[model samples]
Target chain A: MSRVGVVAIRRGIRVSIYLPIAELSVNMIILLAMGGAVGFLSGMFGVGGGFLITPLLIFYNIPPAVAVATGANQVIASSFSGALAHFKRGTVDIKLGMVLLAGGVAGSSVGVYVFALLRALGQLDLIVSLLYVVFLGTIGALMMWESIGALRKAGKGGSTTLKKPGQHNWVHRLPLKVRFRASKLFVSVIPVLGLGAFIGFLASIMGVGGGFIMVPAMIYLLKVPTNVVIGTSLFQIVFVAAFTTIVHASTNQTVDVVLAFLLMLGGVAGAQYGAKVGQRLRGEQLRALLAGLVLIVAIRLAVDLFVRPADVYSLAPGVL
Target chain B: MKRCARKHALAVIGMLLAVAVGGPSAFAQDQGEPPRETINIGLSTEVVAITPDFSGADLTIFGSLENPDPQILRQGRYDIIVVLEGPLRPVVVRRKDRIFGLWINVDSETFSSVPVSYSVAMTRAPQDITDAKSYKQLSLGIDNIHLRPAGENADPSKTEEFGLALRSLKQRSGLYNERVGSLTFIGSNLFRASLALPANVPVGTHRARAFLFRNGSFIDEASDQLMIVKSGTEASIYRAANTYGFFYGVFAVILAVITGWIGRIVFKRD
Candidate 1:
């Protein structure tokens, strides 16, 4: 029998394919569906969808190591697709992305080393879970509050104040300034690089693309244009996630190529449809919806941590 | 599911019948006035092929007791325990403790030569069939499996606790299984046991050992080797990832980039 042929047992139940790296058999249909859903949300919200996909994979009982590594692999496809769209529209700030990527590369190396230490101590899962709770909770709540205010102002016929491109903030006061033409801003490179590196580190640890954190940071802290922020962050994310994948592959050997392929197959197609659907929604409503989703995911993670677990003792393969 | 199970049952029966017909003369050689205890065992599948669609599999072990007196058999003079053990590897078991309102892994133990998967089916419980000492010596039950600490001078009691925790975790994941009264007697002197291999069963040369106990005493044993291997695309991918991991990672990234670029071009409207 051909290896790839559908395995139908006597009971008419189609057997699932095994993922070598994950060491589990998963239904292809389920993975495809998950990838499609996450990709659609990613395209619509201008987020990498890593925040959602990582937790979801864990929920399905995938090993956290495999999930995190493969999650980075899946993010690359969607981020690349989104970045391309932004590039065509001339919204991507290549200089800003390059600056961010430089820091991200260094940060990811450190993150991978730290991840190995945590895994040795058997604390990687706890740390990853806590990270999701803290970052997702804070970011989600803040975004919800901001979007709600925006919606209220729009409802009351009050125009929201937009920050001027050349407005001098404490960030601009720092030395090592650089001009990003697409963003229409002259900002100190220190904070920008530092922000990118910090997010990259978290992304490596948490198995996320870090676009959720990068988007808001650029908008509020760096004062970059909203149109350019998404594209630039995505551009940086492609490199960060790609670098993370290679690091994980060579170091941990945790990347499941089959699982990543199944997810990316659905993700690429779903992203296209999601972008089309996104055009119908207003900016404030989309932000509000995205905030709600982020909050929901955060709450679920909190529940996992706080609630009593069914099994308190866990067994993991020996760390090298 | 029922049909599949039935099919598997029929296949196992057919194989056993073939073996029984071919081996009767060997059994007759041992026949005597005082029927001696003997076991003839064969596995339905000598080699398990793990194709890409290998979710899991069921292997049937069938055997016959040669020259068993009817009265002795009626009095339950024989007990059989069949154990299927996968390849061994090192494993770490962690225990979570509530510390300052949060559950954290505070203690961990590492052990070498731990079976990745194990399943035992017996005619009766180990306690009922044999003494505790023999059970431990033979590794007849999950608790009795030997898991030595990996190069550490650890406390025996602490290691025992960790071993229990490891066994519990593996059992929950369906990696370690123990089933009593699962070895069914098809007819007089003919017995069969079915082992269900989980999807996560490690790939290696595994051994299935069947032990026959008579009146709470170890009598005879039979062992057979079963090779579990990854075949086709699964094998290729696994081989490449391990041998050429760097190139594999690069290929993965490039594949994603190309797919993403193509997705935009094909789907873009206006």
Candidate 2:
């Protein structure tokens, strides 16, 4: 009953028991265990752990940045676990993942540079928040919008209807000929790279691994099958995030290994269970729910932007 | 794993999805007890300045902080600061939002029950003295921290939105890191100035002050100006925007549509 939507609480105000996690207290253990639990969710659903963990951190009165950063650290481990499992299964498309990761790295570099530029300009936070709000909201609405349409169609006894293949356009005609044996398709690597770079830009800018976007891109742009797409994207995300974590850690020690380990422990187990449970839902139902969850997060972020923060210093934990 | 997941994903998703959309449970902690401690904010600095030739000269700022408080601090209200060093004037800059809908790359918020936070509020807002309006003014700055994608801007899209009311500056409000630093407009041909130290600036130097406050007290400001920064060098900042989420979501849905289409059209594979 404790606020079903953890991220829904307004930030900017102090609200909680004010229990600080000591250097190494039960709080730390809880944080680590919770992080792992969130990590499991990320693996099972292949979504960013922040979607779950950051809010949990906030619930404990942890600053949003720390929550987000810690969750990101945890993501490294969870993604690695998922990738390893997928690789063992031979479902991962290593070559494709590499191309996407290349784009992601390049994009992240640019995104980080831009982030610095904006900070120098003094508008980094607002832009990021606003963009997050708008982007997430629209995506959520689009997904929900489409899913509702599906539900309506289904209600009318026409749920399984399919539309014709739209125009292929230039995406298919580019020079490089690449093949995906699992999906039985041979296409240009250009689209893959372009998509990867584009998504990578977002990943770098946002500091997320870009799995939320990567999974879908593999399925649509590169035309991989649904089941394998998640596996393949995980393969790419694992390396990308792990490398990013290491780089960030080596550079700033931002990649909290302890945090990552905690998150991963929970994530691996949660994923196994989530996968088990996910098998029962219809595809649309799952999509609708996931989309809804995503939308809720996006809206909260957007609201945080324009609305007066419930309390200021939303990002300040130690500083505040 | 795949076999196991495929077999169970449906059930798991079904249960979660049902609960997710079913509406919030009424008594689920509408709001919780407030944090029980006073957080002492120690920072290096809160603001920075833009390099010359940047439409004139712009600035960015951030406040690094720490909790001197001994007890566990929840994330909440604490004042941050930004007193312009000089160039004193109002500035306008775009503060872009990701739009208020479900987006692709940007992260969607999630709920959790973790216990690691120090809730507090920053008491200082960035401001500049305005001789024209006869009062102090301040506004959000460029980028959440003076950083952005290439070819994009940190300025506001509207003129009126960029202008700050003295009363608003006088009255403190809530803020999030996402929208911090993005200024609306910083005058044409940029001017230079120093910012006044807001009363409660945490006991640390700022990274870039002029970069954050702009020309004097003409613009509304967030207190990131007084952050710890290397002197005279352009400070680099970044956001956690998650662009991949956008593309991934976009492409994933598109693929779902396409596959469903092709499943029916090509081989009736659906």
Candidate 3:
């Protein structure tokens, strides 16, 4: 009876075990126990469930795509609950999160719509495949360059330039100004609208969280100090993803509780230690490694476009 | 006594069962209710059998969509049945990268209909099939194929069949007796092949199996096997699809901020 329970839960399958002495399966029991450990890690750090968890899901025989969706569902809930806890501690940058959220929501809605469009045209994979190559390739290249620069100036560290928009750019000249006291700046709200929408759209289309895009944009584009970017970004993602989850659920019905919980279970815990470990390692090395990985993936995706490996071609209309 | 080890193992198993299975319910109170929904063409309602149609050759087998799912799969899970025509065609595989990403497919770029796996094979023997291209246009044509609606009539002894199409390096596939042995071959040498709809494809077969043809005869045949284990496979794929951009993005950004924060901590010496 006990073994049965372990197998069921570890697989994230909601199976009832009322047998007095239910026989346990070795695989299932360890898997569920692992979920708990991962969840703990998520609490320590500040991340959604999918990034680290889904891959693990595959380890237990879950399909990659299913693993990914399930992880998303779990991350949505964990983020909501965790964000609330963080809110109580006043660690979250609500104001900043809100701006990003506003844009993220807009972008995500449009992103979903765009996805629908691609689906309709039956060329969604084509677009997604294209965007992934372009986006990952560009970001990977930029990350590699920065990491190299950082490594060259390792001991002679100065400071990253907090670049703002050009004087003639419309963003700086916009009328309404938004201020983040912690970040210590007064920037135009217009940029947030445009930026959030862009990231949000990308997030939706690519099934990505938009943090990779957001963090960099905040630091370089708006010149938001690096100190507050992560926390603020998390705060924003909590809402944006939650909204996306709801939208996907109601509109697309793409949320999987079991998958999410399993991944979240691991990610939350992994994040805590990962944060600790991440702190110890060379940021440059991690960045370089990450860049290399993304570039490799990008090259593969780009070649796929010309080769046209995608099998389906029936087209349809999409919605936002 | 050997009984001692068995007892010890049982005890450990009991302890694990409580922890592993009970773990979910432990937080069941904490979790939200499961959301229920469906996609356009969802469910793998048949066991697609890929026979040795292309028997000894590195022939690329093609499939047609049976049940269409309007909503795309978030957790993409579909098994392939590599049914070949009687005898396979001349095969050359290549891996190349275009604007998209790395595609495992045939060497040709423009006329590349489907991305195919790059594996070399001979009629009498399946050689070390490596360094080949992935299938470019060898998959089914439909995305999000819809299954039976939620409230459709249930027939106890009814099966359904969807249309089938076969494409290869040639336009028309036919039986070639001279080359290696009695086998099927695509007629046209132009590059790609499309759909071959069969008139006698059984009606209402739930999910049926039919041969994939090129010109006028049977070459390769396949079908989909329904595996509705629990009815949540659709949601499984949908949920995890849109997570990467947000979550990892956050991790990357936060780490950068932490770096700056630590920089401040260390730079205090200056």
Candidate 4:
């Protein structure tokens, strides 16, 4: 009997579902729970959950290629759902989003090309794990430090309002200035487009919606108004992630639709309850908790990279 | 003297039975010098459909031997080996090396044609049935399957290493398997062989071959083809993904959009 069959027989339940592209059987309940848990975290922190979901799937033993591609596909659902709410609230800056998308499209195309090259070279898995470790480690540490500082300040009876530093920065001095009326800011289109392109490249390579990086880049570097930051980021992410999904599907044929659909089903439903719970928690505490979680995942991936694998030899289809 | 008489009586009874069932051919063969032995195998189904919940299954192949010498058959010198080989496909085997404190795939070797799966069932242990040279010549066992390296001028040592790795990996994955003593003779000339088909059996045209041997010397062989195919919606989805990838991708996006839209409508919180 196959391993899945043995497991099914042992458990006395019929919860395993076959993934077409991945060509494997996985427990449905486990996938659903994973999606729901990541969705809960995303809703709680107001961040796109792609960063979390991709690694989680990898930890669950899904092939890196399938996980990365399917993660991008799953991101579309949550981003679209979030963007709709922002659109209704009139917080999305259409002009700004459009400019960002132009750069995002170009960057995503190049990223897909590189992705295919690495896969053929058999370096894709290593590169994906390394990138995840670096990004998650840095972001998690920074979030942890910042949240801890905030918590300490609150404990000392001080106002915890986040300080907005000098409005003019090196980013503001770049050429090709443009005005975004909704954001109420005049900024160089060069920095805006560059940032978007950078995030788009990461989105394709890392299988993330790029919100974790994009949100901070917008707030600190571009100095976009806080209200419009998330809305505009989601608007751009919805398009970039969508493009990444299509390109990956066409180029790599790695996207598992069954896997993506399962994740979306659990994610959308879990987000509602997560949002409710999020409202009750303090922002600093939530940030600190999320940071810890991110660091743990990063550490786990890093350990795998350092530790010896069970088998040094592996097989793949097709001739080199 | 009594034992010899009983043996003669049994052989006569066997000869009469063969003549009665094996027809005029048996009579002609009996009149002539001992006839050459032949083997014939039959599969109940030509196409094996794999459903969504398909697990591994045992495939039984029935065969019969013609004009077998009763004395050799009673002595158990006759042995049969049956093999079910999946379609051949190109494969690459990669070896990982530690570089900069990380395990990374540094070298790979490719084979032009390798069976996706190989399942063997033999009357006895491989070593007991035939010599290593004979097995290699016939390519009868898992280790003996010829794995041709893809490119020319490949290092012989490396090719051998990769070939070994390929066989070991396939065996570990249950795709290449062996079942000794699974081929059993029910009558003097009738036998049955059972081969295990893995759950992840590649969907393709597989060849089931039965080899007949007398006293460890090759006599005859027969083969039949069986098609293993994915049935129902799963097969359609697999075909769509490979054939119309772009449209499939668009459909995936549309499905996601609909699911998200439904989620928002069903659980409206904002």
- Each model's total of backbone clashes: 1, 218, 129, 0
> Could you give the TM-score of chain B for each candidate, in order?
0.81, 0.18, 0.20, 0.93
Report clash pairs, candidate 1: A11-B1
Minimal lDDT window, size 10, model 2 chain B: B109-118
Ranking by DockQ: 4, 1, 3, 2
Docking class of 3: incorrect
Tens digits of per-residue lDDT, candidate 2, B18-73, equal: 24332233123122321111112223333443221111122332332221111111
| Candidate numbers sorted by TM-score from highest down | 4, 1, 2, 3
The DockQ figures for the candidates are 0.44, 0.02, 0.03, 0.69
What is residue B105's positional error in candidate 1, in angstroms? 1.4
What proportion of true contacts does candidate 1 retain? Answer: 0.67
TM-score-wise, the better of 1 and 2 is 1
On DockQ, the candidate that comes out on top is: 4
lDDT of 2 by residue, A226-291 (tens): 667877776666555544443433332232333344445555556555655667766567668877
lDDT of 1 by residue, B1-270 (tens): 663354344443333443554355433442222324577788777777877665567668998876553444677868899999999888988888887677888988889889999989999877899999998888778888999988559889889899998988888767899888889888777899978786567789898989988778887888988898888877788878888888888888898888778777777654
Put down candidate 1 lDDT per residue, A1-320, tens digits, no spaces: 21123334312556366787886667788889889998888778777899999998988778888889889988998899888778888889999999999999888989988988898899988898889989989988887887889889999998755434555568878999899898898988999889989977987898899988898789878999888998899999999999999988888777888889888888887877777788888777888898899889888987887777777788877853
Per-residue lDDT for B119-169 in model 3, tens only?
A: 211111111111112121332222111112112453322211111112222
Question: What is the Å distance of residue A5 in model 1 from its true position?
Answer: 23
For this target, which candidate reaches the highest TM-score against the unseen true structure?
4
Predicted candidate 4 versus true structure: per-residue lDDT over A1-320, tens digit per residue: 24755456535778888788888778888889988988888888888799999999998888899999899999999888888889999999999999888888888888889998898888989999999999999999999999999999999998776767577989888888899999998999998888888888888888999999898888989898899999999999989988998898888888889999999999998887788899999989998999999999999999999999888999988744
Residues A41-110 of candidate 3 have per-residue lDDT tens digits of: 4443333433334435544434333343344445554455445445555666668778878888988887
